[model samples]
Target: MHLVPLIECAGKGFPDGFYEFKNCDSFKLLKEAREKQFVSYLNIGATWKPWHLYRSTLPFTPMSSPFHKLYGHLSDPVRIFTISGEFTGHRIPLSEDLLNARMVMEAKLHNLPEQVDRQYSSTSQSTASTTSLINIVDPETKDEVQFNDPDFRNGIVTCAALSLDGHHVALGFGSGVVELADIDHQHTISRFQLDPPNHPVWIEFVHGSHRVAAEDSEGNVTILSHDMTAANLGNLPSGPLPAVTRVSDNGLFIIRVPRNTDSSWYDSLTLVSILGDPHLQHLAPPSSNNFTPTSNPPILASEPSTSSSASIKSDAVLTIPHRRTLGFSPGAHYIGAFDGLSAFTWSTSSGELISSYRVTDFNLWIMNPAVPFTCSYRIPDPVSPRPTLSLTEGEAAHTHYSETHAGHNLDSSWIKCPFYVLLPSEEEWDELTMLDIHSSAAGRTPLFGTNGKRQRLPVSFNGKLEFIIPKEYEPVVFSGAKGLGAWYGDRVPFDPTFLYSPRSSKDGTRILLQGWQTAPIVVDLSQVI
Candidate 1:
């Protein structure tokens, strides 16, 4: 694997005037800025700035000043620039000083509306008015706009998603309410209440459409359209609510329902088509032994089974035990799911399992749409024993051909597919090991001076599979890089933290890695492999 360092900020030491090298626990990349040939990192904390990928660091714009104290807890902070893109929203702390400072700077910089509303927090001093603001700077016009919600002033927002068009945002709150906010006018367009006693567990804006999908803790999936029409997509068979719901870029939705009943062996992963039928259908991974289909168009169940409660046929059902992670290929042609130890890929069109591999500590898997390539080859004369034939063809054909092939020897290649999978190193497994320490300690006898003699768990790359495309296909190859410990120098043992989930840029060209005790590492994929 090839490693290219793009941007590295000090985790322990830094020069004066620079943001203190505190543990960078979280960060997000500004893809909008990236499109403008700039790479910016929004490090969560006092230091929030944009840096140029190729030039000197951009000017640091501090939201906090020494003179004023920002009050109150911040909820979700969202980016409000892109017209049709994700990553437009983020959560920022709710501070009076920060809000007012941002308001003044935005109004002056973007010529926004001048009327600033000051509302006092009931918990704060009566003499002081706490600022509660929701502001975003328009990327196209550089104008700042404020979006206001009564709930923002009182209720706590649990989760939020910004629409691709940047025209709307959907926010799920702890009060069991979901709200759609219009960004241009800065007001709530609509609000829908979920079943009582259950807060929203997940909420997402369906891409390429004006719809939103939200799921509550009660295992109920709610679909909200642009017209404010709300419909329940029906709760899955009585079980634990899905761990998470993901909306593919193509608008298909997937939910991972955990196994709560004794009859089930593993969690059930289901898929739904928001643009078509809204039924929740089970997604089963193909048998590991049956990676390839037996036929061109695999035979499907002849009729829907009456024995099953699902509207879909029994043979159509795909089940994977303990499957938690789910992802759709770029164009929705394939769906990939991973249990803790293995990964499987399924063809969406034929409802057939295409590939399955044992993976060790799978971190990230990305399958871009298959690109088509055409290769033209000259037809050699079968009767000719010319040595020149070696120049055009790498090797001689051994297959016996019918009379029809007597004149033809040329073949044309049609399509090529590429994919990438990232795996974590043994050191990355330290978090898991720490959790197992208690169980191991209970099973072993302690012996003084022999502590260092205990055998360390062996690390294996067994299930960690990497793909190699054939040379005839000439597909784009992605290299993998693991082990960030070497980058820490003497601070290896004290690394202490790592992001549970690494954040990737919108274009998937860059990834942002932040941890509690580590400085943020931004890896540029374009420069790597």
Candidate 2:
């Protein structure tokens, strides 16, 4: 379907600074499965690899695409999978290094089957009043605990899981250690080691129970189920790598349980949604209506049914080739690998492919939502080197100087941000094409001096882009507003400005939104009458 750009939420002019989208008439919203209480998805951009800079580096040359050193020419044809989303709103940035940071966190936290508690401890110099702690709870006992470790003290916690009853929480780390925490009281329940020929790439908890699943770096999926004693669960090896086996080192691993409950075995299959090729379903059945019937149907005979030629095909296993990547969605729907794209949802009772959708390319890294603001601070610019003074001395002397210029338009509020960084792909360097999520949207705005350099489209919520920044903008200092930034889609040449969360008033008629100039913008998305 053609992508459509939206011009207005309901007509009245869009808030200033934030560009508006020109709605697309050709595209229709895919609402076949959408519901207010239905599936929620969290799209995340993958992390940046260390070599990405070198690969994108050019040799004394100015090229359109950055990675001329690595890709050579093969980069042109390949379309990289990008974008990650969750219920909590946020925007993924264009920086590659930040992307890697998010991915490492997600792989560590989401590789399990059950839901657990999570605690975030930031190391940023900012005070607690600014950067708040994030807590995850167990769905069962309602037990809550702090899951953050000393290692991730300052960094963000991207992925996490709690058991069906909230008995345990599997927390993933950038160091590749999957920490399984018990939520009864604050304590280290047990740490499952995935370090070996295959390191722990992802972790997850089984549905409705404490059964946890962890994927090794080799793409091997190992299920850990609890015994009746309510003790530490043992691992049940599903097999050496199913379709999701291709995601190895440099790949992402995530797990999810089924959320849709309209099936017969809704609780049985624990349908593990694998991100791969949505088109694969069509390839398997030739058509959704096509499936070969078993050679023989099961028969309930009165006289102790005797075995016969071509035994009743009561049990059946059908393998369909499709693409899958590691990801997560509402109701615990998870994609199990880090490679390819498209994720699948299947019927647990019949092992039949139920439905599918294209996963936003971000599964390689983080799965998060937007955060709130706190404070603001500024750093002085470095001094220029003089002829006689050493460069170090000049830098030190100038590092404390403050420069404040008006019209910089730096202050702005961002809302519903799912922060991420831009990193290089597994292959080689290629041009960065920031295609609009609303396909029909216009090309990215050129940054003037860059001569039409394209910016990747920022990930947004319901077509809105949000940025994170400080609550108060003071002078030229860098604001601590690292929350989510928002922008309007469907508008061409969208501004580089950020949008903030909509603040409601006591009367609820006028809504205050963060504006591009770091000021409050009032918008009315809903009908006042």
Candidate 3:
């Protein structure tokens, strides 16, 4: 319950980046909730309006960035990135000026159906590679379609992720195209194609290797390799946000629900193991005790479910190809700080970050076993400054401005991966055995120091952070930032609430509660984890 924000914040609960956060009754009420054990949360957004009635109607979204505390909106493409150890974030120019660009594109293409069809004619991966500048003159309407659109192409971001090192980001678009963006330089690096161009619902980067794992809505996965060798992961369980998985370190076995969906985006998980065999078992989320699979983990070189993060400034992007060429980019961008996620990390006694780990569902803890055996590629640096989100927009709404930075050790293949799928009890306050990555394993040698595998501890929290049930929703939720919509109790959700997600930092001390309507919130859970 000790809340130490990674950065400072203003009086109204807004972070330092926001221009002014002088007063907010809703934020105060949320603080009261934390003290009363009703809930614990801290608002991270600047108050859009100071009206007393805005609390209940604050806007929120479902889509968020991949590991860091960044959030995005499906309709409005603006995105923000929060510093580690807190929920307060500054707007990162992910889809910064997308609103204006979208408006322009709409004006240019809205009247020209033929031109629009020709331009977007084929969602096929074979279409001439897209770029920042689109210049096509239609003969029929004698109209021209030309502009500098970010790799996002103004499409809905189906999936995204930060590289292992935290210097880059890979974004999967509804256009069936994936783009690699640079965090340090602030530009897109390259683009990957998804065959049949279905909305890539899941995407990820294989740690220490050069591979991107991407899965479309129809469940088809493309293991995109920079070496031009791509593999098809076939189909996987398909659904909305966070239906993602990671590959094992060895190459075989996809561990679905490797870690229980620890955020609000998913409800009780049903463990379905595609063991790369004739027989597969479908198990439900365990009510009590850890649930182990009856069968050994299958080869993710074959297929795997989706899950994948990064806070480091050194992060890079993931990439791929279409058809039989093979590529991979698994994800659920889950849309929340944008909810920042905690990928496993290891540090030294002096508190210098030494090693970090990525997770895969394969039976064994291979930061991503499938990464080595299967084709992998380190997505190249962001190509150009084709703004997806314009700086103009990134600076709006009293948000903070952030300079893009990168970590120095992105190329390091260092890892401490655990390959177990321990189903957890969703009942709020229930205890679960979790690996304590913060407490390092000192025996590691060869420069790994304390940045190696550590012990597992039984941890618990003091809140009712359960999945939202629409049937239990109330029209008038509480006025506080943490209260259920005008209502109270563990079940707190409504139509707009599901659009967002949440994640923790590498050490798991600060948990980011992501939302779009208002700004994100940070909760200090160091006391629990």
Candidate 4:
């Protein structure tokens, strides 16, 4: 494997810099295997989230089988679920052995009906003490704990969700049961049932608040309030939305509802706020968890002369239109939605919308049927400081529970929600244009620099249709961000480079292309330099 940098300049002069290429040790081996046979198709779950899980199912022959003809007839599809909820992508293989069974589900999509439960047992191993909840540590922070609560010991936990803060988790089971488990406890702290048993597709807990919301199989969304200091509210009157039909992603109180089954869903995200004063219709602040009044007794006072007084109420504040998907900028000021692969930004507080940026062909594309399109965002670094704060605030700040917490700086951080689907573009499709050997446009490319200046690269792709970067952009190989950008477009099918943004602070700086599964041999970038 060769690691070469490209510095190409045309109109002016070649920029003086180094193009670093990081090579993964296993690239060449994996490439040969992929060419020979389809070992497996791996997909990254969430690009920007701390907990990055990669799903891959490989078909392989089993060693043992009862029926002679069935032996070779059946192929087991194994899934590799990597736990990167933390920074480092530490992987643990979840197969029959880890789950103490012969097989796990092949796909991550939980929409499959409840009948699939009977095929697998949640409590198969003899040494297991419990049937459902499995506790695991965050791969990045060894001290952080993660809980995987399987509903009903069944094959599917449809509405399982982890809070943005990684402190709480909620799960809607196959049996129409909804349960909330505290990450700190690693056990179910509260449980409830939706009157009619329906599968819950997804759930989202307010980042820093006690309230948690969930969506059922029938498209109904219900929000529940939890008592502070672990007080049992028992069962409170739940606020339900009748017309949602289906819910995709849920932020503090915001959610995405598809307009219909078709590819073109609503292009706006919904924001629901439960208020303290129901009748006033005016939003009331959620009770603060950290507030503790002094025990000093006060003298009773006579009733005020006023005729009307404040009343307690709960209400829902929603963002006007339904969006395909909603995401918060690194700084909470900007909320975004994707309309047909094009991303639009909005001021969460002022409702002021920003111009849309298109990532369609670059990030979204239609490939062969076998190679389905997968999209996800890269979670920023949690510890890295944000660049600057925004001036305006969205209504979401006033109505969302995450906003009520003192420790959580909801105003400073953003949540990335990525959407991926198979739909044709409205714009005219452009066919691949093969550039001539001496084409001037060949070297006309954007250069990424640490100082934010455009410098000419000393090299180019020579003229290959595409380039393939390494799985993780390692420091030893990549010299600057521009080299990573050039490596991205040059890489043929996919960019193996994984980018990371700081979690709390907002900045545009992202990690570049790291390394590849195969070393550069026949199509090396040495000539351009």
Candidate 5:
């Protein structure tokens, strides 16, 4: 496998830098993620405030499974219930794990229907917890937490996250204040401050664990207790301190984005203990982890481990081109990222670059069924695993969650949700090109030998699935007109700066797509996928 720096891959004259300063003083993405905590603050669009604010990528969360795991066969939409309330438009979830937890306190009478009690049984399946939130709040919920000034006051809310139970909300203020508030009672439960005034830019309640991972403005993470306090067990470390970090959906791992000393763009992605320093476990021995002779300007491993809370000591590093999105396959079997037209996958067990593939076809935006088109597109579902005799095993269609029963052998295989989908950037915005994730990334291919071959592919570099906006509802640039109304046979125009804005259902059956200037619509993936 031969890889080069993203800049070298681009040839001459690449423009723009990767780093940007995101502050709470004007960021709306943080504000929107917290709006549900304070129902009244969920503003839909641009406000009339004199000062303009940075519009956030909308907080459109896909619904998790609400039914018992036994009913895994139900179609994606049927297996769940919407977060019944003002957030209906956002399509939140009732969340299965929450249903199994004991009732903290008797739910408000209005929120829980009386009929639910009669339906409950010790031997029967669980639905009481789910029923307790039906029509929980008005579609137009009453205002609660109001900002001093909509422009900047609201922006002071640096970041927000909801507990797995969806009963608590943790908000980080610009003043380095972290508040843990109860969503059910609309009141503050606890508040704390970070030393030396570090502002949190992102916060997430780690699922399946009693920890809160807060990434500060400078990209340093502080692990807090479930009650929002400095705690004993900390996060698994992934980067040298001060590297930008992103947590997984399951909150089990962290991926660190450390910038290349040579360039402004990040040349590699280090998954912190999940993407860290001394306390973190670094992959042992350079010989154990091997990188295929890919990537131009061969990266030299930088070590001499530093000792800091945010520092990491890595023995093996798989440096690739500039990457943005990071994901893990189920059980974190494989880790990879999309850098430009290339896809790179690594083995978690060996910490080696197992396979890499570059897309040969660029115009893979439409889906044709009679006989599938694009090499990236994985059409027609097979009933069972069929044998295939192809050498390009690295470039097969990725395994969609719906297909594998999401890892059938695993316990609770019916409802596993891993963050593995990839959305590459493109010039057009009306359509979404999905570099879908596969379940297994366990394959091997010989190095670029003299057998006359192209680059080696990932254990799996399945093609792609592309869906466009229904012709009836195209995205508008200004006053909502369809495709710039051209008679010269021009193609439909799109918002080039899509900012990775689409949302997919937990089951991977439906992807909700809403353009900047258009109403929301869903791509029914059940048919094609």
Candidate 6:
């Protein structure tokens, strides 16, 4: 588990004083755009100025436009910045502000929808100036395509997803309307309304296919294609709405649904297969205190069952509670889920529990189904100074002298180190020790140097097990105020600050890491990992 330092950018990169990276900022790794080497993120600064961060090998160039804020605060002003590289010559106004945006395959088409205001009054002067539009910009030519729908004009966009090939973009609106638009034609290809008109919570384009699945607040999931053809995945039990729907690159659709019990709220990870029978696998870990065993054993994919009804079958069930973090391995061989306490990985092919770990203060974990080990990184505190240098040089020396004179004192600084632990296997936890890897001099090493503390990990955890990182992986870490601090895995138990989650590319080769109050750092996973 080694980390390499890559490119790092500060908030000063933006011309305006919009320096902080807020949680609302959009950070994504483009899957289908022509700029394969670049990653995109949107920053809505404190000054109400919006800036787009497109990271590439080329030097950083400030780009801006006169666009309304996604949230549309009255104070936000329009500004202009230059778009370079593949997006050169594109002078797009931020006016078509996107609540959610995704990259699609490059295509030349016309008749893009006009921007419509969320207020939706044909006569309102204010509404005319603040209409929200979806801008599909060509990465190669910098040409811009805009789409505005009557439904979305009056409503807010809750979520969006792009197809694997990037030819289509699926948008979920606040009005429970899901629209599929063709990137080439810049028009709505298909539209479907959720029966009760519940706001769409999650939307995803199935990987390797054109089918799109969207879930509403009513716990109903509709699977559709670009042509509005519906695929019956079966009915879901009446429970809390799913947190997210993940489509593996292999085209496996998995949903993280919540089930309320007498003791606590638990999550169920349900897997729906497109090719075979609409088999559903339910995985939930047993509650901490309620050890009562159920009459039924954990279900597996290979278990023979005779139920052919349209009703979904619980093919496999685990005792662990359902987690919002759910994912499948690269080849769809395994599924993984994480809660606050632990991470569970299972074999999708055999329906066997592959590995599970009781993470100590889990911040973020990354694993490929093809890989044998799961990598977990944690930061003790984002705001605290590094423990190795927490004290001034003179103070550190004085403290060391005081401790030394007090007769064989043990330094407690190791507890403050950030963690980057590798759990080789689920069964190997007992053999691991925090003290085995701790070094009194570790803080002085290059890995824990000042620059190393600010490095960010590129991989993002989408609650899907599929990752762009390979078996032998090297992750890039950013340095400076915006960089991430990592523990050396020497500390046995520590609380983690889940500040920002990292995102990975579809092919598992690149990652986008958003730091606190800083621009996103894009790292090429192929280079180090």
Instruction: Order the candidate numbers by lDDT, best to worst.
Output: 6, 1, 5, 3, 4, 2
Residues 302-329 of candidate 1: C-alpha lDDT, one tens digit per residue: 2211112212223221222221145554
Put down candidate 3 lDDT per residue, 1-529, tens digits, no spaces: 1211211122234445433432454344334322222111111112222221111111122223221212111112212342211212332234434335434444654444444455664554555533311354322223123212333234334445545444455666545767665544555566677788675655555432245666676767666756655667556555323343433222222223311123221122222212222112222221121322122122112111000110111221111100101111112100100011112221111111222223222111212211222211231121111122222331231122121111112112222121122232353114421221101111110000000011110112212221111111111111112211110011111111111112233233333322211112233333322
* Cand. 1 Cα-lDDT: 0.33
Question: CA RMSD for every model?
Answer: 20.6, 30.0, 21.6, 23.1, 23.2, 21.3
Q: What's the best-to-worst order under TM-score?
A: 6, 1, 5, 4, 3, 2
Task: Please give the range of 10 consecutive residues that has the lowest summed lDDT in model 6.
Answer: 486-495
TM-score-superior candidate, 3 or 6? 6
Give candidate 5 misplaced runs (Cα > 4 Å): 1-155, 162-168, 182-190, 227-246, 258-268, 273-324, 347-352, 359-529
Candidate 4, superposed: residue stretches over 4 Å from native: 1-155, 228-251, 257-263, 274-326, 339-341, 350-354, 357-361, 364-529
Q: Model 6, clash count?
A: 44
Give candidate 3 regions above 4 Å deviation. 1-154, 240-242, 246-254, 258-529
Q: Estimate each model's TM-score.
A: 0.41, 0.24, 0.32, 0.34, 0.37, 0.41
lDDT of 2: 0.25
Query: In candidate 1, where is summed lDDT lowest over 10 consecutive residues?
Result: 488-497
Q: What's the lDDT for all of these models?
A: 0.33, 0.25, 0.28, 0.28, 0.31, 0.34
* Residue 82 in model 6: lDDT: 15
The candidate that wins on TM-score is 6
- Better model by lDDT: candidate 3 vs candidate 4: 3
Tens digit per residue, CA lDDT, model 4, 30-121? 33222322211112111221111111111111123121122222212221112211211212222222233112332321322222222222
lDDT of 5 by residue, 115-211 (tens): 3343333344865464453433211111111112122222244455545344455656545666665444444565566554555655655543345
When 2 and 5 are scored with TM-score, the better candidate is: 5
